[model samples]
Target: MPPINVIRNALVAGSAERRPAVLWALASLALSMLLSSLGTSIANVGLPTLAQAFSASFQEVQWVVLAYLLAITTLIVGVGRIGDIIGRRRLLLAGIVLFSVASLLCGVASTLGQLIAARAAQGCGAAIMIALSMALVGEAVPQARTGSAMGLLGTMSAIGTALGPSLGGVLIAGFGWRAIFLVNVPLGLLTFLLARRHLPVDRRGPQTERAGFDTLGMLLLALTLAAYALAMTMARSHFGPLNIALLLAAAIGAGLFVRVEVRATAPLIDLAIFRDPGLRAGLAMSALVATVIMTTLVVGPFYLARALGLDAPFVGLAMSAGPLAAALSGVPAGRSVDRFGAPRMTIVGLIGVAAGSCMLSVLPTRLGISGYLAPMIVITASYALFQTANNSAVMTATRPAQRGVNSGMLGLARNLGLITGASVLGAVFALAAATPDIATAPPEAIARGMRITFAVAALLAAIALTIAVASRAVATRPVRDEFSVGK
Candidate 1:
């Protein structure tokens, strides 16, 4: 057989034999993300049905969604490390099987507890798939096409995310909530079959022993994230002194987790990835973008449904524009990044997003659906570009051996950004509406307060754009990392 160096070089050079496998891997990765993202958004629309079926309140039933998110966030880094230690293909297949079974369990769940438990399992499976998906693409495909392929995959995820609510609404309105869980069976089965057959084997030689898994680091990280999530979930509600104490304890736990990673031999998360200029900037930019994107999403539904008095169906239709635009831009932005490089494409996209936010922020109190749709498209499309470039930059900076763990950390950073964005924006919105004179204030005053939130989002994007531009300048000097791009 050819040497390991030969295979590595071929991968860097975009060899013919590797391209086909890369494409297949990208397809499977995108499909898996679609399923996981779809499950989250779709269930939101079906929450009322689930609530009634389980005899639960809105707050209680929310666990069905939160459990999945928390589980995924907590385990993604650890499971990703596992993928690195074992083989990505092996873990990917196992994740798919687990996800499928969890979905089935969720569908047949007779109570809220059962459903939440099932969702948690589903999240664990999702973490495995999500962490490995990008690594698989990076490993199998050549460097040149990485950006474009990732963009297409991002598009698939965005489409699934956007469609989930509408699909869930339609299903619940017609066939009932069970359909949402059942819908995954066919998709899951197909994904598993394709993955089992088409996913390539690990490139690491048989004699190349695996690294020891970081079990302690994994547990500490999980506990920390759980605590942080709990704190956020309780922030909006009235809590006792003991609850606040627990939240503070969780914060300390997170701090300890960070310290552990800095000193560990084989950290579940490779903290050194933070030192790379391109990577550091790219991750910060991606997180800022996520914060802006998610905040806007959180506020949009409230304004359309409650403030504007739009019907439920109409609100869903109106809100669909953003995701649609995001999905549409993913592949194109990706291709542009590969052709012209990352920074320019990312800045342009962030500017577009900022503009969209400004437009939405100033939307008249008496605005029509057209008012919202136009800005929504701009904001969504801009985010699509940001996501594609940010992901490309992160992946390109890391070596093949550490890709899985790095990808997991990247995913975690992005998810944390998302959670922070939603929380902060919600707080801003609530505070604005809670002013002493709010009842007497003009409708425009309320809109102005919302505008402040949007302005903050815009500022976040602008900062990200600045970093992206700097990173772009750095990328042009032809100084590729030895473990990364150039062989």
Candidate 2:
């Protein structure tokens, strides 16, 4: 088989290649993305089942999900840097194997704590897969086709997210909770084989690999991120003393991390990278848009069940629509970026998201479910467009040596936005409902809360749009036909 990842091979070996090989390679990567997201969403559906099986409380069972999220949030960037320093292919292979073994462990675990630990291990594998998979896109495809590649990966992620709860439900019903995790073992094996055959060969030698490794910086960054994520998630909508303490620790850790990075000879993340206008804007916009998108997930179920009086099955159906729309939109959105240029498409996408959010904010519950679902579909589809374009822009403009870290940062921003949205916007919903106990809030109150949450979501999208426009306005160079806004 010809090398599917031939960006450097074309130059180094002077070898001709067929497009089919690239497709095969891309299939491996797309599957990796799908599995990582599936790991996240599939476990959620099994929470109740696992809780009952393990004789544990809901809070205790939640750690099955939390451990995975915490592992990914804290370790993604650090592992991405490791990929850059050592070699992406090797690290990715190790991650795949680790993830597969961890899945088996999770499935067979007899106790709750053991399962949680296995999930954390599974998360580490996911972090590597997510980080390096995106990083390797530059090597796997032509620069001009970056948007399309990014879009394909985005589509797989959406499909995984959309498929998870329903798929998990089926598996749990048929074979039990263990089946949910055991499913990944076969899938992981396939991905490993495919990736081994198709992934690009790492050409970097070991000369500088050990030199200037910033172990301290990595530790500090991971701890800081962990602190912040725990702070936002542990307290939920209620801010308690523990939340305050974690937040303060996170703040301090962040300060010290910056201090360490600036002084380090080789930083885990170069502090200077944020200086580029396009890159800076891309990361910020990604975080903001992600925050807005998360509002749909956070607020939609409540609105559907309470305000619109939908049944449980209908609530799930309606909830799936946004991700389904996103899954369908991804490829076309990528083609649009490839055709129109990432800069222009980025703005168009953000406008669509902001418009959708605005409509949702003012939507009258009198129109009922259609009123809510319509705007949500628009928001998710537009978000797919924005995400593809933004990722393409950032990765295309980034240097080859730094691509891994940049991709990790983009993923980090999105993850942080999601965690924050779940905590912060959930609070906004409760506050708007004018009730401490949202569970008992009346229908009209739920309607009010939904509207207010979307209004806040709209504002967040607007802020992201403003950032995009401002970045383009002050761009240091002329508009190019590709993803570049600024170097």
lDDT of candidates 1 onward, in order: 0.77, 0.88
Task: Per model, state how many residue pairs clash.
Answer: 0, 0
What TM-score does model 1 achieve against the real structure? 0.89
**TM-score of every model versus the real structure:** 0.89, 0.94
- Candidate 2 stretches with Cα past 4 Å from truth are 1-16, 205-210, 476-487
lDDT of 1 by residue, 133-186 (tens): 877877656678787767876777787898898888788888888888888878
Task: Kindly report which residue pairs in candidate 2 clash with one another.
Answer: none
| lDDT (10s digit) by residue, model 2, range 162-276 | 9999999999999999999999999999999988998888868556543466899999999999999999998774799999999999999999999999999889998888889
